[model samples]
Target chain A: MWKWLHPYAKGEATYRLLGAWLPWLAGSALVTLTVGLVWGMLFAPSDYQQGDSYRIIFIHVPSAMFSMGAYTAMAITALIALVWQIRTAEWAIAAIAPVGAVLTFIALFTGAVWGKPMWGTWWEWDARLTSQLILLFLYIGVLALYYAFTDARTGAKAASVLALVGVVNVPIIHFSVYWWNSLHQGATITKFEKPSMAPEMLIPLLISILGFALLTGALVCQRLRNEILKQEIHRPWVHAQLGVAEQER
Target chain B: MAFDSWYDFIDMGGYGFYVWLAYGVTLLALTILVMHGLRTRKQLQQQAVQQQQRQQRLARRKQQERGTA
Candidate 1:
């Protein structure tokens, strides 16, 4: 089972894999985001109550969703690094943390912007919002820990532990609204039953979510390739790769 | 089709400021992230290229010294 993944455990192989996928990830992200944004902003019907302010949901929900998604991915990568002692997986954690942090910030900022119109406040210490804030801090913490040590391996181990511990917050962030009295609304797409949103609105929201996910993948690949280069700069492979790039240029 | 005109769409039914602000900020953040990733990759690639050049120069100097010896 895991044997098939053995080849990719090598840094060069993993780097090549990511390079192969980056174009597809970026291309699809662009296509889906354009379709979703244009449709959601220009064609999706207004909410009966919130009017067009509800349109902010197009970005807010997706960013909020993917922020958690990125953290979960980081935590899993951390697990692989710590348990299997995989260098590639360790590098993956560093690649993921910044993107997760940025997405978390986007989610919080969009939520605050949307909150002003719906909840009549820029922010609140509600369960959902607070947990999400904590998630952002957790990402920053992981990043800070990863760089705090001069020994890269020691730093990676510390960051991996932090990432694992912080993952409990992901579920808490997702379920906070239902678990506590909160100004934030409950689930839309993740519900057990059909999503509450109309098909017209829900369709675009789903597309936007995919677009964000693809963008995250592309960004992570970009960072991971950089990490590999930084780690392998002295290797003959790195020299050869750079030589090829130079010749092309 | 939700809005009848360009102004109506931009206005976003009187909630234009909030909607546009949210979109604008999200775009800005993502753009920053993408730009930063691109810049970092380029810098690292440059560093690798420079290291390669230095190694080649060292090899060339060693060859010349060996020939003279």
Candidate 2:
């Protein structure tokens, strides 16, 4: 139950846990991404309509999905921090912000590149596009707010509040295409029924999605460890770890 | 494979520019983020080591002052 999570609430325990998970996350991410990208880019048949341009979906859909996923993770961590007063949860918010921001940027960029050939324009003010853009701003806002204050506690508190407020945007981004007549297409993988895509295309897309998720996991672990080090700099455990790290060097 | 030759693959059925650009940009951004994370972690550990050393020096000086006084 919740009891198992109790150990990870401690900074040192969480740090070790992330350390244990990093190699596995990184290795799987590498394997899946390579296989997925190669299969999607080369072997997958061209779309009957869009032809080879559809290959962008391999990266675009995964990045777009994980962008929202990262924000949702941040909101959960923020809730944990506020509700339980967990310092490690607070550090997780900082760990996730920039990665989510980058994912959002990738989504926007890839969507634009995909749009140019399909929609005849680089951008549109459609619901889906604009909502995702706002998501990018929200991530930046959380990051900016986290560092704006001189006091770390006050900064984390303010940033956690902002993250909680920003949770509202995740749903908006997901539903924007449906809520308004938009240029952006509806779901390909997340449809209520089976995916609209064929298995040839869909399989690699799913693999790429797994790759993106795992890569994000590895990146977050690295960032969380860094956050722990930064916050626990004056603690003896941090000093001992650093000394050991030096000896290993 | 979808393409018959190197040229055909590179062309990507005339959508090559868009496809490659998207992939290239995504790879570049992710690489930068990963590299930055690794570099920052090393720097922070170094900074922590320095801070620890400084604290040790300060403590030794305080102990010496108490002994002489």
Candidate 3:
């Protein structure tokens, strides 16, 4: 399996792969986000209990959910790099960290803002909120560790170890509401049997989620290409790629 | 659709501050992130081109020195 996948792990191959997919991701993100946000803000009916405040769910829930998803994704890339010694996967770790960190920040900030009206406070120490805060710290910690060493390869390994350990927190973040008494609401969209939201409310939320996921994908691909160029700048393939870019310019 | 008029939608049933703030902050953060990533890539690509051009100049100079010798 390693041998077969090894060729595609090279920097040039990965660069081409990302370039090919960038347009599709960007287009989908734009379309889905426009439709979803418009539908959410103007079309979806207000919740009986929360009224218009519930509309924040469209942005808040997607960022909150994707932050966890991004962390899990970064960790999986780290694991692949560790186990298979793939350099592209290592670059992917760096590419994903900042994006995940920002998503986590958005989630935390939006949650706090939403909390003021809903919970009557800007902050809390509930298990879910605390765990989510810790998740943000975990992302910053990985990025910090990755850049700490002057030698990037060593830093990548160090960061990969941290990401793997942080994987424990991902599951903790997901189940914290279930495992303890918390002010944060329980899972709504992920409840397979029946989502707590009405279909009109749920559809826009789901669309926003898809839009956010595509946006994440587009950002990661852009970063990954940048990383590859930075690391592979001296390679012949990189020079050839640059030659084409120069001509096109 | 839920609002009776434009003012009512903006009023958000008296929760406009909380809802708008959340959406606004999220949009601002995401925009900042994407822009930063793009700017970094642009800088790196420009640097790569400059470095390549410098290396080529040095190689050409060395060849001329060899020919003179």
Candidate 3: list runs displaced more than 4 Å. A1-4, A243-249
> Which ten contiguous residues of candidate 1 chain A have the minimum total lDDT?
A240-249
Summarize candidate 1's per-residue lDDT along A1-249 as a digit string, tens digits: 679999898889998899899999999999999999999999899999999999999899888898999999999999999999999999999999999999999999999988998899999998999999999999999999999999999999999999999999999998898899999888998647988889999999999999999999999998999899899998878878766344321
Which segments of candidate 2 are over 4 A away from where they belong?
Answer: A1-3, A244-249, B66-69
lDDT of model 1, residue A64: 89
Model 3's chain A TM-score stands at: 0.95
lDDT of 3 by residue, A104-222 (tens): 89888888988899999999999999999999999999999989999999999999999999999988989999999999999887755788889999999999999999999998998
Q: List the candidates ranked by DockQ, beginning with the highest.
A: 1, 2, 3
Residue lDDT tens for model 2, B1-69:
879999989999999899999999999999999999999888988888788777777888898899999
TM for candidate 3 is 0.95
The superposed Cα distance between candidate 2 and the true structure at residue B10, in angstroms, equals 1.3
Candidate 1 lDDT tens digits, B1-69: 999999999999999999999999999998998899889878877888888777777888898899999
Candidate 2 is graded, for docking, as high
Which of the predicted structures, 2 or 3, would earn the higher DockQ when compared with the native? 2
Please provide TM-scores, in order, for all candidate models, with all chains considered together. 0.96, 0.95, 0.95
Checking candidate 2 for backbone clashes, the offending pairs are none
Residue range A145-230, candidate 2, lDDT tens digits: 89999998788889999999999999998888788899888898664687889999999999999999999999999999999988
Off by over 4 Å in 1: A243-249
| Deviation from native of the Cα of residue A122 in model 1, angstroms | 0.5
